[model samples]
Target: MRKLPAGRAGVAPAPLPEESASRPLHSVSGTPSPLPPAPRELTVRALVMGGLIGSVLAVTNVYMGLKTGLWESGCVLSSLLAFGGLSVLARRGAPPSPLETNLAQTTAVSVGAMPASAGLLGAVPALTLLGTQPPGWAVALWGVGLGTLGVLFAFSLRRRLLEEEALPFPTGAAAAELISTLHSTGSAYAARARGLWTSGLVSGVLTWLRDASQLVPPVSLLPAAMRVGGMGPETLSLGMAWNPMLLGIGVLVGLQAGLSILLGSLVAWLGLAPWLVREGVATGATPDALRESLAAWLLWPGVGLMVGAAATSIASQVRALPAVLADLRGLARYGEGWEATASRWVARAVLPVILLTGAMGWFAFHLSPLYFLLALVLAVPLCAVCARATGQTDIAPISPVGQFAQGAFGMLAPPLPSLNASAGAVVSGAASHASGSLWSLQAGRLLGTSASRQLLVQLSGLLLGAAVALPTYHLLVSVHGLDSQALPVPTGRQFKAVAELLTARGLEGLPRSSTLATGVAFALGVVLSAAARGRLARLLPSAAAMGLGFLLPASYAVTLCLGTLLAALVGRLRPSTTQTVQSAGAGAIVGESLVGVFVSALSLMRQG
Candidate 1:
């Protein structure tokens, strides 16, 4: 066991024999923290800051997901963004309470995850490819409606997953750690926040110089993008972002995931790409042409390995699902009828929104009533599955689940496949993704915060995120078509390809090579999951990440690895400063991301 925190004068609080390390480290001495409790929580400042931060993150997420087929943890990013903003408020005679901070984070993460959930760049574009371009209002409506539905189901899950099942929501735990550390211990975290701001400032300026260099030609001299071949679409390029965020993230994810990511980068860039080129598996005269060809081929295997690994990891936990569901039986009854009870919360407050959401899908998207109802029904179980997956790995394959929903609905509404795709993605993808965010709230539940408050914040942020993200999605699409290399909405491509293939060729349509790759990758995914139990797994790279590395250009992946290697070197040399370095890195990521958004907006305005 680790050393217990000292209570007073060399005395340590003894832990109970039944206590396990699985519990949060917050219980340092098997006792409540002595920090003064917040008298008032759920402040206006928290809501405003959370919404603003979430909107920024939503835009960033929408943009990044289109490019990378991945999203960062809202809990981590939102916590830092919120704290950095709120600390300024604290200095101006308006310090937020700890509970308020948690509430803000609840809102931030919920909405920050909105773009991916709402399928803005994922399933929505799949519909676009199949002759359906939903208006901005429909996009907003789908996002909020489905997200609220997810929130309702999430309420039912808290007891089952948190209290009974005791699943570890990794990202939520991270937020709680940040919240408790800052509010309780305070000084250590305050200094760390300084590192964040400092790095963010530097990253922001560098991003501006890199992205806006066309306007100021002198700035173009800076090494923003490192391209090896003819600086064209098919170049063997590198994104030398000059953004320190990757290094900081490396520090936080730790040496194992870091090294794994690094290894994947090397394997792809140093070994795989060249091998493919030599064998004529990937052929191009210029680097740019070859990369485009390579990415097309690589995405199949990459997605298969990644999703397969994640699914297999979740599947391994199936034994616990029955127990989790069984635990929910006791918590379903309402206390004393008319008087609202914990059990009746969903029935009384949420059922109306759900009904309205379904109606919206039926009317606006032209989804059949039966299919809409089916989607909602399926959402409950899938949300549960996603929530658990999120708790365990912080990686819920919501898009895949949504795609599954699409297939089910497509079978029923064979003629209007696009409509069914939209319904499935909105219902399953957005809702389940929203449900995954609930695990962050579970962290506050452990600390005795109000679940209702968390729900309020989440719903509010959901609205804000939907509003911002939908319009942002449209703007990005207008500027750079989804098919463009600069904005390759990969998940959307997957959805489109599947929809087209199923519609045209049916089962026989799947390419032989892709099927073979998927099978091999699936087996490897299972193998990785089996090997994931031991401490040595730390050195193991994520099968999903490696899969992504395969899809993305080698330069970007290699740069990411190099950043982490720098983090490893720092951790080895001056371990104490690693946290600070990580904060700086996280800040740099945000800073650069925001700058990218700004530059994109500038270009859009000029074009308009």
Candidate 2:
């Protein structure tokens, strides 16, 4: 599984243009496919394993996203784990085939993405913050509908993105490489597999000690009373979070993104927040409530920056749309009727899902018929942009899709937060699932697996993921609530802040200083995002990441930045061990997250 990088929601970097052309898939042993073609791709065992892995990941994602605003699509992880587990059973007459692995991976990734696709981690939580709670089943159905819509879109664009243009979806490519390596004779996977499980075990044990057993005390880098110029470190929220997942995400996202968050955190916590409190523009009744109080003011500018940055990134991605559309036209000839080929089946699957989504939106979310329908319509183009961007950079701009939808409905809808938020959810969910599906599809294509079978596996995983995601969300929310410090829900808070900002009577409801800060932040976001698309792209900070820094606890930024530096140091000092670090980091995230969910469930049961 890969977490969303900094600025991932919408401000993913522009695609690299000067890449090599497509080539045939080969094993790490420098040979064509080592495994023979499978008699079946979508076996019952594959579906079961996919669903199991996906369901676990769906729970983990909800916990991770709400706690840290970082979520992953578990394609690579699923591939590795499935291969390792199934290969053991291979000696009993059932061989572990690459195509079957692809099917399992597809199903797992689909299921893993359900939390984001269903808006459980963001939009739904934002709605809850605003006091609107849809029933759990409704949310699950809504997620399923959106996920299905995305899968259909992925099928439509597979030919254009994968078969024709041959964009390198790096994450998918990694999964393919893993499959190939696993299937190769005298494989090098044993070392990696060991590192993965070992790190996972250590992290899980630590999480248990810290959260469940309570034997380990919280670690703070600064004393609460450590002061500079009449301000204390505690007041500024300057501390590092001691969590394995933060370290893992930092390693994955790298230095630039970590520095970007640090930059934003310094600005918000040290600069803007202090000034606001000093000038009485922001207030809290007690010292304990100060951070929360300040966040209410900070998120406006943070969300503004995110929106601006996303807009710029989306604009840059738009240039590829014309070419993508032109290539898509080549799918079916003019002579083909509605019932002629695969396009007909796609249409049949798509139309009813679309209608079902619309119906669900109306009955469950109180979405306006015209507004929500428009959101679904807009998702088509936005999903195209997301697909192209992901293929190019392995970052799906799902947040940007929702941010765009929010902006559109903010103006068109009747200033209702629910209406606009639901619209955003519809668009974001569809785009997220679509991009996720493409990653799976990309892996399938490289392995020469059956696309149709992969599609079915994805749909099956979607249903299972939806079932798992909603209940897990409720469980976490029931234990932590939306406002608890344990689960800061930065993305959800951002969504809530944006909904309120869009619904506000212009700038009338905000402090004058806050309005000014928001304007400056928005402009800076746009300029920074534009700069990131140019020659200094690698050197510059991500505007969206900086914006997230403002929304998250300063400790999160500090810890994640430290992790980034740690990863960099490891890479420079011991290059050969870099992959080991990566595997350990990924394991840590999975380990801690799984334990975190288990602890949450235990806490919930105790409360009952």
Candidate 3:
């Protein structure tokens, strides 16, 4: 067996040979190692770890949804912190095998859905609006059902997406780096875990205070009209706000992306929104109404154009698919052999356990079994298509497949109540998330971990997430009255309102400033792609997405962008420390979000 450089743990020192490298490290040696053991009290430990981390994730998810109208990033960021911290702490006694590292990375990232999977909370407003709430068993069953559905959907797509089409699992990459660094440096996981806990707690407290009252002060200093001035007859606007975490996101995204997002916001708020307001097409002061009106007139066309560009660009890369698939096939065959030979059975056991858990969830919950089955079936094809569409031929499109499966389920079940739809949405979120976890696992596979062990750890985290998060959702909803018709959670309300407006207004011959902005931004992105060339250009889509995020509200965008810039500046100043800086920033985001969620949960607990 080829050995990596001494003391350089967690890093993939070099890509392994075609056959031997692809097999699990333990399996290749023909020595059956016992299952890779976790702490003695593994189940209890996992639950405790999950509960703490899950609580934090829940809060951050809600805060982000309420604050920026996005939930994915916050969840992703929090999961990174949890897993990264764990990996860092685990390095003390014996270096975690690649399998263990992969497991931890996968588990942490998988558990990230805590916030977005607000099962019952999501159903509450819609149920109330419809004047119905399911029985407790029904709700629990729903949670189990949707969670199972998500697993099935994610699993079906896993092979094709994770193995064949190499997607840029960005968050996974970050997690891998953290794990590698900690092990290499011989650091204790306990210290890192403590850091995560402390940071998370602080973040949670601050976020809670901000949401609880007016004491934090609104970040927007500009009046509505001033922000909306210029950019045609539409209402264009901007504002300045303070949010450390969002700012960090902006910085990490970089100036170009941040600026692009700002431009998107300018088009929507400054140009289109004001026009609608003045024309009496929308009511001022109602951001949700404005967003819907703008989305109707501008957002869809912009989305179409962007999709067109991505499709065109990606189609050019389709020739690489065959090669990528061959690579994955080779890995799968090798992995099978490793499982047969390796004694480290724990990791190998993960695949079956995950599958079993998913099946159990399906039966326990009353979701349509067909949807769950279909999700699995469609995953590979969808991932392949998305990979082809996005020109990411080297990286498997596992994440996209997961996302599409969930999205498809949601679409199919749309007429159902919000809670049910939310369940579907959770499926999508979790599946999309699994893509990243799979990516981490693949990374470990390259570095000599057994596939079975990696799979086990990842599943451990996923189950942990489900176990802790569902209750947290109920607690938050009950305490905060999120399910109340009078005070629906911000994101759900916004989504509902937008859907309503689209239904009422229809999409025809409407003025679309956001669409125009998107058009211009996309053109600019293409130029950026040309200028950046190679690896840099790969970030174009993310940059464009960031721009779109920014174009929402100036105050929000500005703060986020600034935070991102600060992080970037640190990266530039200490080029060698980019990963650490990123980890710290991500930790802060998770911390703040967790604090907010815990507070909300606590409030609910107290009220109950």
Per-model TM against the reference? 0.81, 0.90, 0.65
RMSD of each: 7.0, 6.7, 8.0
Candidate 1: minimum summed lDDT over ten consecutive residues — where? 1-10
Candidate 1 has an lDDT of 0.64
Model 3 CA lDDT for position 182 = 50
Per-model CA lDDT versus the true structure = 0.64, 0.78, 0.45
Leading candidate by lDDT: 2
* Candidate 2 accuracy as lDDT: 0.78
Candidate 2 per-residue lDDT over residues 327-419, each given as its tens digit = 445444311332136556665666689888888888889986787788876787788888887887677778877888788778877888777
Q: For candidate 1, what is the total of clashing residue pairs?
A: 5
Per-residue lDDT of candidate 1, residues 67-101 (tens digit): 65656656765776676677788896767655667
Q: 1 or 3, which is superior by TM-score?
A: 1
- Model 1 segments more than 4 A misplaced: 1-38, 80-84, 90-94, 214-235, 238-290, 320-343, 363-366, 403-424, 431-436, 498-503, 506-512, 534-536
Better model by lDDT, 1 or 2? 2
lDDT string, candidate 3, 212-269, tens digits? 6546753545664444433222223245554555754564555665665665555555
Cα shift from native, residue 581, model 3 (Å): 2.6
Q: TM-score: which candidate is best?
A: 2
